[model samples]
Target: MKTIPVQLKSKDYDILIGRGLRAQIGTEVAKVWSKRKIALVSDKNVAELYLKEVHQSLEDAGFDVLDLVVPAGESSKSLAQMGDLVQQMADAGFTRADGVLALGGGVVGDLAGFTAASYMRGIAFIQVATSLTAQVDSSVGGKTAVNLKEVKNIIGAFYQPDLVLVDPDFLDTLSDRDLVEGYGEVVKTSVLHGQDFFALTGKIKSVQDIREQAEELSIHSIRYKAKIVMADEKESGQRQFLNFGHTFGHAIELLSHGSLRHGEAVSIGMVMISQRFEAVGITEKGLTDEIAQRLAAVGLPIDSDLVGTPLFFKHIVNDKKNRGGILNLVAVKNVGEPVIVAKALDDMHDFV
Candidate 1:
């Protein structure tokens, strides 16, 4: 097992990554919560696969575990579900002293993390991310929230987890499409960091290659994000780079109405943004095409069927990064270079 420390202003935490670390969750979690009960939040899919193992581990460690299972999917991240989970935690005798165990992919992490953040005004929590997307992206960052009717991740908080336990073995059950979708996020991280890191993706083609390189790839991606988050935890500056493809990605997801996966949408969004950069002469045409082609190779669409440029631009206007009606955008000057552009909302239509 390899443990990485994430240093934060409020408190420092550890991210333990390895194969078969699920069996050690109880002892690992015990270091934070001694006799305090833990409320575990998971979805139906993950619950069927590993919930029993987690329950047995915690039970062996003498923890009073209360299991709360929600239906799996993006739609489950609603205000109603959040309220229900909060009520469940309370009925189970939870307190600020107790911990929350987020035991699924991004949706479960976001919902449960927000619950832990809001319940009792804030409680300790641990993340046991089950998907590749969650392990490399959402689980490490403290950004937790559910979606609102009008916006994606609009209602969320930046509450850091007490610990992040990532077991790559959990990925064995993922379908081919889901596995391929995760590479979109991996590619995003690679682009933000640089080309050498991006080149590592070349060796990864099949699902087995993704698995064999999972440990190193996850650690490398997390390290880049951790450094950026540490430098600007509140996102006043450098951390914005992490949202390289997210602004456009979130808009596509909104337009698709949850029909499109987040990473898949982001893959297309990244391609679109790269094209915008090329149009403005900020990036070379070949490089932009290469990015789109690579994403296509992994089964992510580089363009969407959504029919209106103005509507797509409207979503960009609503993005959280828009400041004073000006969009703080990240564009590529080349494969290894990312430049931030501040543009007025009116000028966005030309690019879209």
Candidate 2:
């Protein structure tokens, strides 16, 4: 198994990446968390696929496991779900000493991680990322959140997991849309990670190509993000760079109301911001088109009509990146050159 150690000051952990790691879940979980009980959290889809294997593994290690399976979708990431999941943990007699094992993609990770972060003032949190998006991006950042009706990640905390398991074999079962969804994050990372990595990612032509390179690329993206997170675990400075396409991407998500996936929304946001700025002599010329090509190469959407509209502006203003009314938006000047452009919320309308 390949390993990447995220050496944070308060919460240091290792992201274990390999094939067939699911069968080894018990040994892995046992090594990191010495506590007794583990509340394994998963979504309906993922649980149906791999829950039994994981459950048996954990049980073999002598953990009193409580598997909580919720409906699979963005809707599951909510205040109501959060309340219900934690209440279930309380009823199960979970305490600060017990741990939470997140067993699906980002939504499950965020829901389960937050459940761990807030339950009895935070407990052990472990992530076993099953989707390509979770393995490449969300699983490592330690930012746990649940979306509000109109806002994204408004209710969240910086709670690091005790461990993260990224098994590339899990990507085999992803639907075409689900597989393509992950490339949105991969493209974003390639763009932010500089030209060499960008060129490497641009070479991927299809979902098959991505699957072939999943392990290698997952390591690259996680290692890049882990470095930034260690430098700024609270997202105060360098860490903001990780959110290369998330500013307006999040707004587009709210506008879609579940029609657009997070990856699709971010793909559009990345191109839109690049195009808008490149037209005005801010971002490098043709950068937007280049990015759009790479995204389109892997079947990711690069345009969204909902962006730049009045309702979109309303949603963008509520972004967490906005600081004291001045929105600090990330824009690309060139490949590997991303800048934070702070604009007053009032003048943001002029930007569009």
Candidate 3:
């Protein structure tokens, strides 16, 4: 097993990545958690797959485990669902001494992490990420949120996990489409790290290549994010770069009514923003095409003709990155170097 530490002073935690770490979750979690009661949160789909084993593992380790399952989709990340979870934890008499275990993908991680954040003003939580997106991005960053009616992640907090357990073997059960969508995050992380890293991703030929190299790829991506988060935990500066494709992507996701996966929307967002940056002289020409091609190679959409330009701009105005009237969009000078660009909400029409 390879461990990457996210050094955030008092909030410091380790991300454990390997092939069979899930089987040892109880032992691994017991090392950090002295609490007796633990809440295990998962989606229905994931619960059917790995809940029993994980539950048994915790039980064997002497934890009083309470397994909670939500519906399996983005829709489950809602105020209603979060309230239900909070109430359930209350009824079970959980306290700050107890910890939450998020045992599924990004949706579960975000929901459970946020629940932990709001429950009793804040309790500890651990992430046992099953999907590639969770393993690489959401599970490491501490950003947790639930979507509102028209916005994605509109309600959330920066609650760091106590530990993150990533077992690549869990990915063996993912559908082909679910698996490929995660490569979008891998591509985004590579681009942010720059040309050499981007080039490394270019060599991956198929989903099989991604799976075979999951350990290395996941570690690299997690390390990049960990470094940034340690520097700017509250996202006042450098951390905004991590949202390279997210601003436009979230709008597309809301417009699609969750039909578009987060990574899929991000794939298209990166291309759109790159093209706009190039046209405005913020980035060199051909960078857009390069990113689009890389995303396309991994079976992600490069562009979507269905997204209405006006509505897209409407959602951009509501993005959390927007401060006062300026939208703080992350632009690339090239593959690895990212720059934050501030634009008025009215001025956004030119880019769209």
lDDT of all predictions, in order shown? 0.85, 0.89, 0.89
The TM-score, computed over Cα atoms with residue i paired to residue i, of candidate 1 is 0.96
lDDT of 1 by residue, 1-352 (tens): 8888889889899888899899899998888777778888999999999999998899888889999999998888888899999898888878888988999999999999999999989998899989989888889879999888757888989999999998888899998777777778888888778888788876666667787888888887888888888888888887888788788888888888768888888898888888788888887777777777667766777887662456777778779999998988888777667778888888877767
Ranking of candidates on TM-score, top first: 2, 3, 1
Counting clashing residue pairs in each candidate, in order, gives 0, 0, 1
Off by over 4 Å in 2: none
Q: What is the lDDT of candidate 2?
A: 0.89
TM-score for model 2?
0.98
Residue range 1-352, candidate 3, lDDT tens digits: 9999888866778999999998999999999998478989999999999999999999999999999999999989999999999999899999889989999999999999999999999998999999999988989889999988777789999999989999999999998788888889999999898776788788887888888888888988998999999999999999999999888888887788767898999998888888888988998888888888778876889888645577887898889998998999989888788999988888877667
- Model 1 alpha-carbon miss at residue 90, Å: 1.2
